[model samples]
Target: MRSNIDGKRLVDRIRKYYKADDFQVSDDGLSVGKDFYGLNKIKRVEVRQLGWRENAVNIVSLALVLSAATWAFVPQFGLIALALTFVIGFSCWRKYELRAEFIGTDETGDHWVAIARGCTKEEYSVFKEVERTMRNQV
Candidate 1:
């Protein structure tokens, strides 16, 4: 998951992975370049909603963390439990609020997937906009 991604930085990364000839985003979000995955073709592009499977895992992990904090007090376990709790909590919050997935299929039948999960709202918005623009073109 990526967070606090600068729009300019994100664009730079995209350009780095995909050459100017390989991938291009139009000023109007109308025309788009292919050459993704060496399959210079675009079949369909859409913003996909990630299901509850991941969320469920986070929820369960959080629950287990709480239980550990309450019931387990081993000297070594305390620090580990606290750390795990913090991680799980952040993960749940991110999944619930910021992250979104965009998937595009190339003509050669390969899926190009990008996930945007940011800690800050501004970062999340930037990535979301990029995904939306790419989806609109296709």
Candidate 2:
């Protein structure tokens, strides 16, 4: 697991890499650049529950892995395959967190950004906070 310090460093790196003319930071760890929406800029924040495609792929991969494992001659390989199958199955059934995206257009072009993700209250709050901040700021 990554420590808080590591996460902080990563956030710092992203901020530095994507420096914008304007930015907003929230206590829940939400940050957005004014240019996140590109030349058009995002005028609204939308909370979207994404990941259906990933969940579907994980389910399909799990089926394939289990079938291959069942045919494997080596018992050890079967055991490893079973472990992987379980992990994939769990991920497919797990509750996924909602994702935040910026949407808007600019004179130059359209812009969008996927900000944060996690199955935690803090993560959800971050989305709400960002929306509130954007409404008030822009």
lDDT of 2 by residue, 1-138 (tens): 579889868755653332222245433343454323332244445555556676667676886778576757666577667667767665444232323334433464534455544444545565565556655544
Tell how far residue 42 is off in model 2, in angstroms.
2.3
Q: Please report how far candidate 1 places residue 28 from its true position, in Å.
A: 18
Q: What is the lDDT of candidate 2?
A: 0.52
Model 1 TM-score is: 0.32
* Deviating ranges (above 4 Å) for candidate 2: 1-40, 50-54, 57-112
- Compose the digit string of candidate 1's lDDT tens values, residues 1-138: 245567657655643332223334564332224322211344344433444675567666786767576556675666666667766565444431322232334465445443333334455454456556565655
Clashes of 2: 4
The true-structure Cα RMSD of candidate 2 reads 10.1
